[model samples]
Target chain A: MTTEMTHTTASEPVTDRPIMTPAVDVYENQDELLIVADLPGVTSDSLSIDLEDDRLTIYGRRKALCSEDTPVLMGGGRAFDFRRVFTVPEAVDAEKITASLEAGVLQLHLPRHERTKPRRISIRTAG
Target chain B: MWMTWNDFDRHFAAIDTLRRELERSVGGTRQSRRLGRWPEATLVDEGERFVFAVDVPGLTQDDLTIDVHNSTLTVAARRVVNPPEGYATHRSERTGFEWKKSFTLPAKIDGERTAANLEEGVLTISLSKLPEAQPRRISIA
Candidate 1:
């Protein structure tokens, strides 16, 4: 089992009215770290993932589906924008990160650095 | 080098309470739907058909089951959590949940004529009103 993940903070452009921090899940394996986020109502075209100075930021805007005339029988949070940031650890390979968005879920793959990966030890035969 | 939403609040606390309230209400962490324990949903009543939509992110059409018994419509689904192989979890804010929401419509609906589609994580279930339930103009001599 891997050790407890180190929690780091990230930064983003400040905006008024508060930003919705989309729920996120992060997992790490031998080769890479994966982050999955649920961003309902956000489209592929509107979503963006950026990594700067070891800070990874996920941004997206949700277009309102309900119209004015439509009567909303029940009201939910109704947030228009989503934002979340994470500070990348030293083990992460910053150069080779990939992301994809499907069905309102965003998945990010951050590979580990070649030097940081674990290596198997070879046994030598006694002479 | 690292910053979380908590740190951001330390920098500025404007609208902090509002943001927290919104998260609590929208996250569906508690206060399940009025009918029962289900995801947040909205219903729009059009003249011809009524549209019911719910926020079920990370769910496909196959994950849901919709059924209409009498005048009541029931929606049920389960979200599964699958972590990658040899993975060690860091943050786990999004968890799997089983949701079921049902509503009693004012008018009877044609069960066979219903249509449902899942797009961008939103599940839309549309039902057309029965012919007799639809409004019609009666002309008198």
Candidate 2:
């Protein structure tokens, strides 16, 4: 599995807004894998998630509350978009995958395919 | 001894499992260069009122405490991490901490009329300037 760099050089950097990698935590269990990401100021309309070809990508855009054109009394926080990518080794149940956004936090649940889950075999006693 | 197709596949699977474990343990954590400036804040002057905004994602209104005194506004919050049940953490990059920050206003503020709102993980506080501080046109005869 590999992590993708948010600030890629392939594309020219947007002068007013740059790209940022949102912080995330990955959790796994026998039933499913849980991915939690923090995307501040991201709205439902601006957030996007995609999974294809064993790659999972999370992208979001946040509108700046204070624009650069306006007069500034103090400046600290800069405006930026968020993006992150991850690779999945095992086949996931795409139909069962669920995602939700609350308080700007994104939570994704990827259930393992039934075929990929471990199963116990029963043995019969010899007569 | 000769290798069979099944054996070859099993060997590769074991090696793949080992590689996956190593990657999980690597567990990257970025932002060393931008340390000490978390939940960045900005203050902007909009005519008669000033707007102060902060980026505190994944935070609820109850998780924060705000105090305003004259031209100084203080925002404090203590974040707690609570992992869900029946889950094993493979990588944890999100951190929790007690953070407090203050911003200064350019003009005297009418504290009584100041208002703060939290939406989509951003906290925006509007401080209206006092009547004395508002710009007034002066005429000379």
Candidate 3:
């Protein structure tokens, strides 16, 4: 089983605000590893994912678009602020890490280090 | 018999009042809709196309609705709160807001033929570029 460590931090501190809880899914394939995060109401421009010295940080804020002038017939109370961090493993290639956003989902791909990638060695039987 | 001016004024005032209320209710005003905030999402590009996956646990495919228009993709869903009936809740972390998400497609995407599939509560959308958007080789004269 692959072991992982997670840490949470906020780039901009907001006092008395509830912490955002983010759910993540990490997938690995022969070529690279993928990290998918579920962050609703977050746009690509508003999201920030950083990898600093083996620690990967994901942060974002969700703001309400509704105005006071408009009447709210119904509403639900939910937490919007979210922040999560993960300690990347040494097998991940930091330089090649890339991320994208679509449908409120953020995906990060961390390519495996060239040296860590599997290499097939040819075996020759003694004749 | 001619109705008194006072009575006619009252009748007309009642109609005007009803019209004002109808206008206020049906006018082009955006009703504030609050969306339940879930976790953030990450998209990964897999050589052929982009794989968009979201971490949504305890949700089934029937709960999600995905719509694509032009270059915009919208994903909306409702997460029903499953609680024991007549059970008093002390504290709850789950927020029962309807989730609504939208994204603008990049130039390298074929908005017409996009496809989406959900697995294990994670939605994967395959976005491929049109033939024209893809790079082609032209011979130099």
A1-127: candidate 1 lDDT, tens digit per residue: 0111112223333654335567788998889999998887788888888888887888888765556676444444344577777889988988899988888788999999999998988999999
Error of 3 at A57 (Å): 0.5
TM-score of each: 0.72, 0.77, 0.44
Clashes of each: 4, 0, 16
Estimate, for each residue in B19-44, the C-alpha lDDT of model 2 and write its tens digit.
34333323333452222125556667
Best by TM-score: 2
Candidate with top lDDT is 2
lDDT of 1 by residue, B1-117 (tens): 345788566523423432343345455533232112236566666656777777778898789999986556888988987876789998777767886656666557889889998
User: Could you give the interface RMSD of each candidate, to one decimal?
Assistant: 8.2, 11.6, 15.6
The number of residue pairs in model 2 that clash at the backbone is: 0
True-structure lDDT of candidate 1: 0.71
User: Clashes in model 1: which pairs?
Assistant: A9-B2, A9-B3, A9-B4, A10-B3
What lDDT score goes with residue B55 in model 2? 65
- Looking at model 1, residue A4 earns an lDDT score of 13
User: On TM-score, who's better, 2 or 3?
Assistant: 2
DockQ, model 1, C-alpha based: 0.33
Off by over 4 Å in 1: A1-18, A77-79, A120-127, B1-38, B131-141
